[model samples]
Target: MFSKSCNYAIKATIFIAQQSLQENKVSFVDIAKEIDSPTAFTAKILQILVKAGIIESVKGVNGGFYIPKRKIKKTFLVQIVDAIDGDSVFQGCGLGLSHCSEKHPCPVHDKFKSIRNQLAYMLKTTNLEELALGIKSGETFLKTL
Candidate 1:
């Protein structure tokens, strides 16, 4: 459903949002560990998120990453997906074909459209704050272990 980078971006953003709610900053190492992603790969994803204004990067001895308080509630999962994976998740073919459309439909095109619409709705409606709270309260988790 999402690329590895997008998955990490969502996890990292949720983790950062939780820290932001606590008025704390999170290091790349902490984010990588929490998300169960490689540090280098997580750093690359964070760079994208920072550039997209999804998260902030502080540069100092005590610096780390955190989402602005204003953004935590306003930022949608769709925005993070757009920043990391573009509109491909919403627009791309169900079978990964370059040109599968209604005119030239794939085997599962119609069925997939419904699923894609549901996913889009979910992404558009789910914001970072709610997801962060789920993690903060231990009702959900970013990593299996």
Candidate 2:
């Protein structure tokens, strides 16, 4: 349901959040390798993330990318989606019709509305901290095991 770049962005953010929790930073190269994305594509995604203030970048010899520890708890999935994919996923038609609104509903409009609402709710309520912790504790896998 998300773009490929958005998927990598979420993974990169969670990884960065985990490192931030440990008072560490990650280089873009490491982020790409860990998330199984190409370095160039991950670079573009990370640039968007940094521009959106979801992560920070530094340029010293020891510097890299990291999120503020306190901010991760408040960084909801919606924000990341918005930053990378915009709010269209939350507001677009189910069947990809440009005119699929309430007045001119698509065949699956009603059903998809419910699913979209559920997705929106999940994104709004879910924060990066819990996701980062899940990986940190070995309770979840960001990639296939």
Candidate 3:
């Protein structure tokens, strides 16, 4: 699983990518509305994304947030996760133990490690373009309707 901020970041990125595909930039207000995230929190998440090179922002009247059309396909989900949550999810102990590791494994360490690997693969392979397209097609969504 991911932090609430990271989840919102992913939704916001996908929304931005969808708009980018249509050659439009999106305001943080619109992104927050689409993802059903609080404005201040969304702004924080956007800042992190921008700093991570996962999204871009512009200033002035015609300015807003957008992912480059070309980068959409190349922007994997893992990048957003890393930007917001870092690599903690990948190496973190399943049981939330402070000193859990291979030799001093948690009760579910082996199984949890496998699950983490699969999740990492999923994140690494999943890209914003595909997710955005799914939303644009109305087959998927970032928030409850």
Q: Which regions of candidate 3 fall more than 4 Å away from where they truly are?
A: none
Residue pairs that clash (backbone atoms under 3 angstroms), model 2: none
| Candidate 2 TM-score, C-alpha based | 0.97
lDDT by residue (8-43, candidate 2, tens digit) is 999999999988999999999999999999999999
Compose the digit string of candidate 3's lDDT tens values, residues 28-71.
99999998999999999999999999999999899999988999
Worst 10 residues of 3 by lDDT: 136-145
Tens-digit per-residue lDDT, 1-145, candidate 1: 9998998899899999999999999999999999899999999999999999999989888899998898899999999999999998999799999999899999999999999999999999999999999988999988886
lDDT, each prediction? 0.94, 0.93, 0.94
TM-score of each: 0.95, 0.97, 0.97
Task: Give the higher-TM-score candidate: 1 or 2.
Answer: 2
Measured on C-alpha atoms, candidate 3 has an lDDT of 0.94
**What are the runs in model 2 whose C-alpha is more than 4 Å off?**
none
- What does the lDDT read for residue 110 in candidate 2? 98
Model 3 alpha-carbon miss at residue 8, Å: 0.7
- Hey, what RMSD does candidate 2 come out at? 0.9
